[model samples]
Target: MLESLLDGIFNGISIGSVLLLAALGLAIVFGLMGVINMAHGELMMLGAYTTFVVQNGFKALGAPWSDFYIFFALIAAFIVTALVGLLLERGVVRYLYGRPLETLLATWGVSLILQQFIRSVSWQFAAGVGVFCLLFFGALWLISRRPDFEQIRGKAIAIMLPLSGAISLVVSNLLGQTYKFAVTLPWFGTQGVDVTAPKWLRGGLPLGGYQLPYTRVFIIALTILCLFAVFWFLNRTVWGLRIRAVTQNRSMSACLGIPTQKVDALTFAIGSGLAGVAGCAVSLLGSVSSNTGQSYIVDTFMVVVIGGVGKLVGSIVAAATIGIISYVVGSNALAPLVEFSPFLQGLLEFFATASMAKVFVFALIVIFLQFRPAGLFPQKGRTVDA
Candidate 1:
């Protein structure tokens, strides 16, 4: 039972990491730009699709590049979505910025357009072995051709985001070595384990009756490292300072020589990049799909709202809280009731079959909003600023 509980906790943390990545972007766009991006979820969908494409590309090319495709997809999704986001901001969102209602309606329309486009292009292409090699090169060229960052602080944050993830991996490896921890996957029906720890740390330490997986150790360490990096970026960096500035007062920052337009574009890009990384992480756990982002949209936004607007700290708190609550409620509280209650069980069984847990959670957020109008940690005295 204790082992099962530990497994659940591990799963919850992994899931929360993905939510944190998705919400990080939404929080920045919504809080900083004061634009409620209804299509934010679709941007995430694009990222997941990018992953799917890259994975398929590897298979089609017969390249030994499956594992590396995750890295490529992260870069590709960020570039594609960031460009899309910039165009949306410049062409549509910018004009409707001050008009909140129109912005909402227009973006909702944009979302539908994107969804239909994805649906229309759902057919698979089976070209010759190396047909897409040039296309991949072209995509890389397009990404690199983006204009240089005008703001120093913006450039700094752009560099730091990925660096933070790398640093986390390193720290996780180091800690694994000191503790003699390793991650192993069971192979076939063999008694021996498949040691999958980083090259530097290959041995395992026994705990109780079972050997703790080194992957779990790495995950825990990485999670802590990501948490630290997030805190530091928000609190210690100059770009972080600028991000906070714009979130509070865009016009004022523009007047103070902040290159408000550039800031907006970069902020959107950084947020989108974070989402791309999250999608890559998701691919590790399950099959990637065109609609993967749709599954997490409601829950991720709830974390943003429940964490309060424009506050990174709030996001962290909200993510952890919602992750624990949802996992506990969804798996333990609801599962047994549906299993044992006959009539009630049948009703819940039907709902469960339809994946209504997502809808139920969305409804709960709406109900909660009615009681706390500004959300859990709303920015006080600044409601009228946007």
Candidate 2:
């Protein structure tokens, strides 16, 4: 009985670790920045795909390297997603800072675009994106650095946008037939892919006469590392202080020459990158598809909301609470405790199934929210915009 209880608790914590990873980024971006970025899930999807690509690259190098691909994949996922997040912020989000509705609509569109792009990514498509980003970022750089270029910033973008498309068409026509990768008759990447864990993480770790899966143990350890990293980054670093200062008072931070815009951008990038790391961990559990991020996005959001907006500790507490409750109820671990009452046993049997467990958890969260609307830990001041 003790063994069963411990197993359930461990499983619950393992689940919560994933939630912590997913929600850590959301808490920073959504809770701190107040941007309704609907594309956050898509960013996680992109991270998973990035991992797939990295793993394949290692496999191409043969067997010895494939086992170590995860280290590289995690780094690549973080960098790729962070860059994408930076682009989203600069291109769409910056323009719609205070307009939550517009940001939501715009990011949702971006999410769809990203999903389709991955589903049918071609060499030609890759070439076109490269050309576009080159021209686009180059023009922006020139405008920022050169006084004369600033006058034609709008004109540069207007011309460069179409010019890049034209260049892509030319490149595709000339070199498309030779350069081929996922050149499918219809679709190659749509079926999704799975990432096998390394040999070291494949087995179980014996603890208290009960075995705990190494993957779950690794994930829990990873969560603790990430949590500490966040704390150290936010509290022990110079940039973290700047992020906090800018978040608290943008105008004051700007006046103090803190580069508020840059801080906001970096903060968003960090959050998105953390989401990407979450994707890497997720790949260990199941197949990664275009819809992978969508599976956990809702639960992640709930965790952040229940944890308290902009409160890291709250996110931690809330994730653990929700994870434990969901796992216990779903697995019927509490059955023994309620075995004395026949009516209660029947009720538990009905509602304690895996599918029905989430409904109960959601309902509990809603009821909790009714009593404490600000969440478990409320922000001290007016952090969110009206």
lDDT of 2 by residue, 304-379 (tens): 8999888999999999988888898888888899889999888778778777989999999999999989899999
Stretches of candidate 2 off by over 4 Å are 134-160, 173-188, 207-210, 384-386
Tens-place lDDT digits, model 1, residues 253-285: 888988877777777666666565555545444
lDDT of 1 at 369: 82
- Positional deviation of 17 in candidate 2, in angstroms? 0.6
Candidate 2 positional error at 346, Å:
2.8
**lDDT values for all models:** 0.61, 0.84
- Stretches off by above 4 angstroms in model 1 are 60-64, 122-236, 333-371
Error of 2 at 321 (Å): 0.6
Candidate 2 RMSD computed on C-alpha atoms after optimal superposition onto the true structure? 2.6
Clashing pairs in 2: none
